[model samples]
Target chain A: MNDISTWDVVRNLLDGVLWTLGLSLTAFVLGGLTGLALLFARIASTAWLRKLAKAYIEVFQGTPLLMQLFIIFFGSSLIGLELSPWLAAALGLTLFTSAYLGEIWRGCVESVPKGQWEASASLALSHFEQMRYVILPQALKIAIAPTVGFSVQVVKGTAVTSIIGFVELTKTGSMLANATYQPFLVFGLVALGYFALCYPLSVFSRRLERSAHGTRAH
Target chain B: MTYAFDFASLLEYRDILLAGTLRTLALTAIGTFFGLALGVLGAASRAWQLAPWNRVFAVYVELIRNTPFLVQLFFIFFGLPSLGVSINEWQASILAMVINLGAYSTEIIRAGIEATPRGQIEAAESLAMTRRQIFLRVVLAPALRKVWPAICSQVVIVMLGSSVCSQIAAEELTFAANFIQSRNFRAFETYFVVTGMYFLLALAIRQLMLRAGDRLIGGRRT
Candidate 1:
């Protein structure tokens, strides 16, 4: 039997960082597109679409991500569908991210001055044409800083998927800690790995926020 | 085979659920009270241009903000014991939550402090107010008022995030659900009910925090 050394534990933990990044990327991409859909639904002319989108956002935002992962992973199995941890984590995070991003983007859209809408309407632009041509471009500019800011959240959120047996950074950290019997060292390294990924994003978000504010101040 | 949903079976665990909910509320209350207090102090030090403490707190906020709360919890709950500083799940949960909330609120409150008109502070100084007096009486309340809504939402986020405390067996709502599901093997039913409870709890906490904000800092001019 081979015993795991400190170096081996660190090496395996580094591997886990890759999965964390991969899952985060997957969730962000899928969640971003879905979230854009949700934003439109939230502000749609149809009253029911807005209501339905509101409820969807509330349910996802209100519950803990851990429970959402659990239900999605376990509940699917009860219905005779074999759901992988990867798929479940992706789906759970995508849904959760969609709700938050939807709300954030909706705020950006609504914050656009009323005159823009009125002017676009007077131009006889259809609702779709107005959103596509006039409103979304402006909203997208307002949304950029926040959307990037939210990506930090999406990165940290991937850690929760470890609980559902996904072999992300946190999960591997725990495993290496158990094998090496050095919880402090192993988890410390894992925290560093996460910090390395998230800190730059945090700094970038702040810069984007400053730039956004700078433009607005002018 | 059909899996019939039996929510009635969950009624038997109502006591456990209620106890867990109360524990969660207690943890949230304790964490928020101390966290906000500490955050104001941290923000004041930064606002006052205290050199090393300001630098110290800046690093602290960045470190806490960048890391995942679960890893933070594990480090405190699991890692600390190895160094001979032992604490129970409840203590660890509270400590982690408070520390996490403190870091977040520091940044939020500091933003408010930065927004304070410089003239206001100068006027207070011209009135012969001491630094501490000016900070506490003149700055803190208004800083809190400016950021009250943001802080309230963050508090609710912390409350919702507290469900992760169950990972350390802190006996919060999530823990209750796990305990019941293990016994009855009704994982779906258990999580479903608990999720609903959490949704309701999040709503209730938001309402409660907003009311507390209004009462505490609603009316007075800065």
Candidate 2:
């Protein structure tokens, strides 16, 4: 039996941080794309599309991410589709992130004044033209800060993927803690790794928020 | 491939599921209560502009806000025992949740508190009110009213977040889902039921918290 040194633990955990970053990036990109579509649906002219999008958001928002991960990981197998942890984690997170990001974006889009729509409509712009030329450009300004802010959440949310045996930072920390019998040092470093990833984004998000508010105030 | 879903098998484990749901509800209740209290104190202390307390609270909020809650739970559950401070899984889960939620609510409540109108506090000062009286009577209620919705949303987020506590084997709803799945080999069905329960729990908690807020903090003059 070989003893794991502190350096070995830290090195292994650092490797785990890479996976965490990868998963976060994957989820954020995929989720952002899906979220845009859902956002349009939520604010669509037709009543049914908006209602359907709202219901989708409600289900994802109302349930815990842990359960969603579980369903994706284990539930998929029951239906004859075997999924790796990576696939399950990515899928589950994408769904969860889409719900939230969609809602955040919808709020931002709606924050555009009703008069803007009226003005754009009077210009005889199509709905697509109205959104593309007038609405989304304005909404995008408000959305950027919160979107960056939500990236923090998407990062932290990756931690739950550890439950399904994804070898992300938290899971690696758990394994290292058990191996080294130094839960404090291992998990402390794990938290620090997360803080390293998340803190900067949080500060940047706040800065963006302040600047956004500053511009809005002006 | 023909796969039959057996939700009926899940009913056999209904008692465990019920117990887990109740435990989750209890954990959320206790954590929300203490978290709100801690938030109020942290907000007040931060608002006092007392140098060290403000710095200390800022650090606490930032650290907790940055890290994942699961690591925080592990640190408490696993790390504390190694340091000669022994605690059970339930205590650790609740403590971790309280600390996590407290940090969040501190920022939210502080925003509310800072938004207190300057003129109102000055009017209280003109009446020869003590600082504590002014904070309590003039500042806290309206600040609370202003931010009750945000606070309630945070509480719901914390409640949904509590699902992670099951990882430490605290016998929460998610734990029951795991248990029933292992028993019946109905992983999808078990989690599907559990997810539905959690959704209901979140909805119910949000409604109850909002009503409670209305009773406690609403109806006051803005």
lDDT of 2 at B61: 96
Off by over 4 Å in 1: B220-222
Report lDDT (Cα) of residue B128, candidate 2. Answer: 100
How much is B173 displaced in model 2, in angstroms? 1.0
- DockQ for every model comes to 0.81, 0.87
For each candidate, what TM-score against the reference?
0.97, 0.98
Off by over 4 Å in 2: B220-222
What are the clashing pairs of model 1? none
Best by DockQ: 2
Each model's interface RMSD (Å)? 0.9, 0.8
